[model samples]
Target: MRAILVLLIIVVLVAIAAIALGFVNVSQTRTASLPTISVKGGSAPAFNVQTANVSVGVENHVVQTPTVDVKKP
Candidate 1:
């Protein structure tokens, strides 16, 4: 019984110490600088007349399996 009581006290003390450490860590200030970006629209470029001819082709193939076997005992 005494051993169990001492073990319980030790466990409680460890828990209290962990809680205190966590509080200390939580209270500390963190210093960090984050990046910032700014954008602004200016004058647009003048448009020019253009012409183009384009062609495209695509091909697809398929596969076939003949036999599959499974055995269990």
Candidate 2:
């Protein structure tokens, strides 16, 4: 399996080199172009949206937290 993979990679590299060196010639016979599209002017539909009013507030609370002490020798 490994040998087969290596051989495949080598073949790909050689093909690429050949194409780069002009030993392989590739060309397109027919010319291609995109189709022309014409869009008519149209008005977009309007939207009437009613959103609810939201109120935001913050609350504070005091809690006792444990303190830790570390000693190094």
Candidate 3:
């Protein structure tokens, strides 16, 4: 029993330490830089595109009553 209790305490302590470390990691602030790309002038053909309008409809229906029951002893 004593050994079991000690093991449980150690497990709990480890869990707490892990949670604290997670909090520390989450609270940290880091910075990062990203590269940029530029395009130069090039001979390209001009094209025209046409788009059509689309209609969408959604409907939902409930078929049965939902209920929850709790019992006490």
Best by TM-score: 2
- Candidate 1 per-residue lDDT, tens place, 1-73, comes to 9999999999999888988888534455888888898879888799998879777889897989789788897
Model 3 C-alpha lDDT per residue in residues 1-73, reported as the tens digit of each score: 9999999999999888988888534455788779898989999899999999899999999799889999998
Backbone clash pairs for candidate 2 read: none
Best by lDDT: 2
Task: For model 1, name the residue pairs that clash.
Answer: none
lDDT of 3: 0.87
| Each prediction's TM-score versus the true structure | 0.31, 0.47, 0.31
Better of 2 and 3 by TM-score: 2
- Reference-based lDDT, residue 73, model 2: 88
**TM-score of candidate 1 to 2 decimals:** 0.31
Give the alpha carbon lDDT tens digit for every residue of 1-73 in model 2.
9999999999999999999999999999999999999999999999999999999999999999999999998
CA deviation > 4 Å runs, candidate 1? 23-73
